[model samples]
Target: MKRRFNSIAPSTLGLALAAALPCLASSTAANAAPAAQNETSAPPADSRRYSARGRGDRRDKWIHRWAPVRNMWEFGIYGGVWFPSKHLELFGPTMSGSGSGNQRLNTVAPDVGLRAAYFPLRFLGVEIEGGVMPTQTRSSDVSATAWALRAHVIGQLGLWSVTPFILAGTGLVGMQSASPPRGIGNDQDVAIHFGAGVKVFINRWVMLRLDVRDVVSNRAGVGEGLTSSPEILLGLSFTLRPKKKKARPRDDDRDGDRIVDKDDFCIDVYGPPPRGCPQVCIDDNDGDGLDNTEDTCIDDPETRNGFEDGDGCPDEVPPELSEIAGIMEGIQFDTDKDNIKSTSKPNIDNAAAVMKKYPSIRVRVVGHTDSQGAYKHNIDLSQRRAASVKRAMVEQGVEDSRIETAGVGPDQPIDTNETADGRAKNRRIEFQILEGAASKTVKKRGKKPPKDELPVEPTPEPKPDPTPEPAADAAKPVDPVAP
Candidate 1:
């Protein structure tokens, strides 16, 4: 009988192997085709294949929904220790000397198995396993082997490098005794198992797997009851399917601009800049009629009030300031002294009045002296003269804070100092309008302008014509005479 059983087992094993081999080959080919298809660049025809089905196709939607781990396979072999329950019943008759109730399976045995799993979705998989355990009846000392074939539904949570899973399954468990003094040579029972395990991925294709499970079975015939066998297994698993490659996107420029559409600010309009648009299409941030690239002051609009209009800066010269400059003359000072002459009072008063009319205007009073004196002394005299003019303006209702004073000796002379008339012209007062306009020096004209050029104002009463005679020391004083 043992010989017959051995022969039948080999035949059954051969048949199972033959059936499984073809399936394995077919599955491998099918899985490889997708990988090969993904390996090369997809042709234009192939790219349109999915588009023909429309974007909302259910099959395509379902496949892409679980992109992470879908269509993956894992195959592994494991070895572990199986602890049989004390309630495991024996099939053979017990010896006359031994109590029948005392018969049980061995305490522990080595168990090994092969498992194959398929992941249809990211979080779920189905696995099939087959295992064998060598054991013996403890009381009887009869050698036996146990076999388990299981099918499990696995639920797993996949993280970066680790996956933890729980599984439950039902299958057939068979036990074969070696030369047992029993009625039946073998026993079979239906078994159910549940377990939890973790897989630690060592890399893209290899992983370490561990499991702990409790398998429960119901024995048949007399002395029958439920038996529990617990197992702990550790092994390695390898991915059976190659990863599919992702398609590369095409770089296109819809507007014929050099910039790709993905980076183009204006995808529909063609022109300069990475914006893919015309200069006119861009905003004038300063409202200065110039785009940001052309405007030096992007935030400040060009005044466009005639002066330096093309510079895209604010430089509007107030007309009132120009008028004030025209009248700022004849503010003469005593030779080498900072005292303003009484004769120049009208001009100073006129300037003060104009400044008062335009309260927003500020001016810088600059003094000049002929180069007839020591350079240092001339500079000092010029500064004092400028201050004197500022003081007079302040006394006449103009805010002292609105006026600034500066002195430049004969270095900036507008006329030669060789003659008295030229010297007189050089030692004159000038005004520079400092606010809301470009700075410009205003000198008194040697001759009076036409009535049309003179700004309308309260005319001063005419005075008797009188010119002071030169001081006796002024004819021949220092080698470089002071003006």
Candidate 2:
């Protein structure tokens, strides 16, 4: 039984695949182009030159476009053969005689039916049907005739134009057969059916269909049999009402910004900045005080001052500041102090040199601490650390006031400080542009500056202290006993 079932499995799967081909083809075609007639409209001559400018724009529109066949109802008809696989038994009193010999009679049978269906949802529908067949067997010793009335509820799945269906229901089987004497019997039974088929839309009002159905039934005293074997059917289906026209695709890009404006907060502009929408026409995607349209160092804001042409990008590497800062881990510092460790100096210097090169660009050096310390202590510590960094830059020839300092105590840890590693990771310093000095320089130059002169160092301050002692230290007594 298992082998027989397996043998038919491939054919059954093939039929299912064939039935689904139409739906797959339709979906592919729908996605390949716009549902609208002008899916591939050509741009006007003037717009062609600015095509690159609007790439972000077109993509925004495509995302919001609607599909053409979203909500439409379809109706159709189907027909098939019914091959009976078992016999109907007729019982009567004493076939020959109780003492002489006992006998029983049975007859072979066949059946046929009609099919109708309606779709209430995409890829699904319900079907109602009825049919008839004969159950007479040809023999001199005995003869029988059977008639059945069946009503089944069918379920259908649409794959493009093809639809596959299954059905199950209860019906009455009336049997009549001849032996030593004529006899009749009526029994209640059940029928189960499954089928696969395809529908071809001829127009808005009609469709052509082809299908094959297999049916199995249970008859009292005759066991179970294939009441309806496979049958090839061809039929026509008439639509009861005209379907509504599909809506045109929506334009997803809401903002004129180059980015595809999808669920973007900056609905009017495109933003390349992570978690932000572009608000201005300027192309500064990272919001690092450097506009990508003008900054050569768009990825590294620190290098913005080292480049000329107000494009906040770097042109040359400073010998003293060759080390790269780890933005992900942040700048490490000494315990309870704003002073960056000697190991981190190279990275800080690199950043400072970049700032010095762009004299006009100023940076905000922010200090953060782990939550282990008191809030006030952490705040003071963070501020002191920020001040220390600024002082170091000033000592390295950066303008005294060009660097802004701030302390955010244990408030913004990138990781939870409940663990040792996380606390260590949270103690850090970061550089942010307070004002775009590169943009200012470009504006002052009146025109784009030479790329070679991009590394314009800030005018050096004379003997300025890079680090300032806390005001509390200055007021403290040299010795506690002296006070």
TM-scores for every predicted model:
0.39, 0.29
Off by over 4 Å in 2: 1-80, 89-113, 140-159, 163-186, 219-233, 245-483
Give per-residue CA lDDT, model 1, range 294-329, as digits (tens).
555667876644334445566646575565663266
**Cα error of candidate 1 at position 20, Å:** 70
Top candidate (TM-score) = 1
- What tens-digit string does per-residue lDDT give for candidate 2 at 87-117? 3222333443334222333222344455555
**Candidate 1 lDDT score at position 248:** 26
Q: Candidate 2: lDDT of 173?
A: 47
Instruction: Name the regions of candidate 1 deviating beyond 4 angstroms.
Output: 1-68, 95-102, 182-184, 219-225, 250-483
Model 1 per-residue lDDT at 73: 92
Model 2 C-alpha RMSD to native: 31.6
lDDT score for candidate 1 against the true structure: 0.68
Candidate 2 lDDT trough over 10 residues, lowest sum = 59-68
